[model samples]
Target: SQQGEEDPQALSIQEGENATMNCSYKTSINNLQWYRQNSGRGLVHLILIRSNEREKHSGRLRVTLDTSKKSSSLLITASRAADTASYFCATGRNTGKLIFGQGTTLQVKP
Candidate 1:
């Protein structure tokens, strides 16, 4: 399968804490993108790291990629209750379709 599945499926964190999630996939991919969905809003792109890259950071978000293991992880630092939402990882391949796994829901409490 080309899709990536995230572990835990859900996460809860304090307002000032950090949250981490892991995803594992079954095939080779060109790149991986992390997206955030806030309630009913459409998913907003958070970050994208290419297959050759190992790690990347954007503001409060950090992403790690391991092409050898066909997996990736997303970390949110100093999370806020406003950050409460669902996070999804999409694996992009030559097939032109991004396969998304069941997402991980994050709840941040104030």
Candidate 2:
């Protein structure tokens, strides 16, 4: 398994619905971060949850981390059509590098 890999490959939802995505990592990590990438654009950091923290939230985004299972989940509340993008999970290493997940493509319909 890769260091940071996301499940469900892709997801589609109607506007105003909630979107949930999951990620799993193989090795130990200091923190896990989520990023959103629009088509043909750079990634935008969404949230970062430390190993010691169980959960964190930023506006419409909610993240949950489970160090025991080596997994994390991202929840986007009240999703909008503009929210369509690819979401990736990144494992923060001690060496100041991040191992990114394969990413989950989300399509929010209007």
Candidate 3:
């Protein structure tokens, strides 16, 4: 099974700061998605950028894809304390299964 790996196992930042995380995958993928998980909350989809797409943005979230490098990145602008959570990158396959990365934990202090 193909898998994605996130860098900087953890991160810390003050409220209203910016946070950046990267993800690298093993094989070709249909799409790459970013998700956020709060302490005890379910994973919430942050954004999805297709393999052919270079970049996408949603509110304060920005995502970039590099198919040639088999990598992707997520940037959160002006992050808030409520944004403290675990971020994961998922590679979607034709089978409809998503392979998740280990994740990056971000702590935002108010």
Each prediction's whole-model lDDT (CA): 0.91, 0.94, 0.93
**lDDT score of model 2?**
0.94
TM-score for each prediction? 0.95, 0.96, 0.95
Instruction: Arrange candidates by lDDT, descending.
Output: 2, 3, 1
Write down the TM-score for model 3: 0.95
- Candidate 1: C-alpha lDDT: 0.91
For model 3, give the 10-residue run with minimal summed lDDT.
1-10
Candidate 3: tens digits of C-alpha lDDT, residues 35-93: 99998889999899998899999999999999999999999999999899999999998
**How many pairs of residues collide in each model?**
0, 0, 0
Superior candidate under lDDT, 1 versus 3: 3
Report the C-alpha lDDT of model 2 over 18-110, residue by residue, as the tens digit.
Answer: 999999998899999999999999999999999999999999999999999999999999999999999999999898999899999999999
* Candidate 1: clashing residue pairs, number: 0
